[model samples]
Target: MGKKETIRKKSPPPTNQPVKDVYPTPPPLPVKAPNNGRKNGSTTTGNNCASTTTKDLWDDLFDGGYRADVTIKTDNGDIIYAHANVLGMASPVLRGMLKRAKGCGEKKPISIHGVHQDAVRVFIRFLYSSCYENEEMKEFVVPLLVLSHAYNVPRLKRVVEVELEHGLLNTENVVDIFQLSLLCNAPRLTLISHRMILKNFKAVVATKGWSSMRNSHPGLEKELLESVIEEENNQKEKIRKSKEQKIYLELFEAMEALVHICRDGCRTIGPHDKDFTQNQAPCKYRACKGLELLVRHFAGCKLRVPGGCIHCKRMWRLLELHSRLCADSKVCRVPLCRNFKEKIRKQSKKDEIKWKLLVKKILRTKRIRGSVSFLVSSNSISS
Candidate 1:
């Protein structure tokens, strides 16, 4: 004994039918015209009720009843009824087809292939009414996108792209959608799908769709791999720039602290006029306390030669920077400021350019930090 095949009923001529078909590849059945016995161009509601809005009129037209002028045949021979003018106005590609078919005095059925009949029904529904059920959209979005693209329906294409970008896109189907986006020339969808692939590379590459695409489309596979590498390199570059920015910001803060200490001093270090023995309140500058310790170290370190000690070399560099930045180098309280100014004149052109570049970076960093107030005014370099 064999199980009997289920014969599903066709969609009735009505407004807003629930989209519940499971899209099984049912065997082709005999085609029959809908039996709504009404004359063409008549949309009488029979109850004498008025349609309150344009949407209601469009809905009535989409219901087709007996007014549809043409039929659309789907991949599995399921027939959908629609108006010629509606389809013509909504899509230029369809208009062209309809124009070429004008010689056939009677309208012939327009055949749409490569997708399920249920999807074709939804596509036709949207063309007439600019409306669709959520369930139908969820089930037939990809097919709808393809139909929209093929038929040159930009509005429907845009809507489908948004739907895919916001809700339908996932790692399991992203690779397929990415390829579709390229085929359809949807730049936004392409960008979004590409980002999803890059962000979830392992999961996306593991999907069956990606596996199929890899086997059949080696060029695309190579392109995606190159993009992944480029994305990684871009991330590395961002990290490097962030680290460099941090160093420049620190140097900027250190420069500010150096000027503050030289002019007003911290709790334990200052010029001849400033007191060094008073138990002053904690320094307001965040870097001042650290710079005070380094100053004390620089004053007492025995290995103060150019290459002798790292700490002294750091102090020497700071002092040299201050000299380059100071307008009144001769009277600047910072030790070696005058000496560095004199010695800078004898430096090689390469060394001078390097120091000038460093100085520019520090000044640029300071300018970027517009909120930081200066602590000293005398002889500071004009930026």
Candidate 2:
């Protein structure tokens, strides 16, 4: 009876579990870089891929000939196909026009005023390529510059500005460009134009553009005149500084020459022709303001004295020069020992450092002293 009852009582059914995935989708096979191997995995593809995808969806649409629901027409009746998204991304002005205009679609030609077909062509190309330049591209610059400003394409405007800087600005076109720059609110272009005009003011002023500007825009002409005057003032100041620097260098050379001359007694630089041949007396020439005084002082002065001789330096330098020229250093018999090899070496080494330091000293001296004299003593020649 118990075994029959066990058979009658049924066991509870087993719970079922869903199957787990054998392998997570093998993480997208690691991307392969180019054969160059220099590029890492992170290096993005080409500009085409970027322009066609994230940064330039319009580029992809334009290339694929899709979603291009509008037509842009130039003044020459030349037609250009474009996507609204692209034009909108490039220019707020275009975006605003598209938003405001009615029935402006593929059927209706959106006339872009005052732009030539060639310029419109380049402008469209730029929106897709993000760049433009070359010899051929230069001709289109003015038109493109105008179009970029009108359309509010700042990036295109910036590129054009940099190109103008590299361009060969000349008298024929600089005035036109300057006026255009003012009209377009391009400060960099304006600045460059001003520089070109100032550099070649005579040539630039002679041009038709300058005359046109002068007659039509006198305010700008006045500004140009003011700039020219300002430039002349700047140039004059530069010349003055240059002259001052030259004088300073000459003064330094004179000082060096003077010290050398006094260090070595000059034979001709004395009042002692016979050294008082009859009486060994101080010569009367020592009391005069002439070559005699210069000669006597230079022939007898002690150069190694701690306190230096400043007043007689120039005269001494002149005498030393005469001595050097007269003495053939190879057989120099002068008491100055002009031929002494060690003396030459010592002078060279000593003067080398002094020469370099002179420039700095000159600058300091110029700053402190109001001005240095270029005038020399009338008796310098006699001395």
Model 1 per-residue lDDT tens digits across residues 141-248: 888889999998887887787778778888988898899999999999999999999999999888999999989998999999999999999999999977877787
Q: Model 2, 155-266: lDDT tens per residue?
A: 7787778777887456788998898898899999999988999999899888999889988999989988998999899999999988877676555444333333333323
- Candidate 2 Cα errors over 4 Å, as ranges: 1-67, 104-109, 133-136, 264-383
How many pairs of residues collide in each model?
0, 1
Model 2's lDDT to the true fold?
0.61
Pairs in steric clash, model 1: none
Q: Candidates' lDDT values, in order?
A: 0.77, 0.61
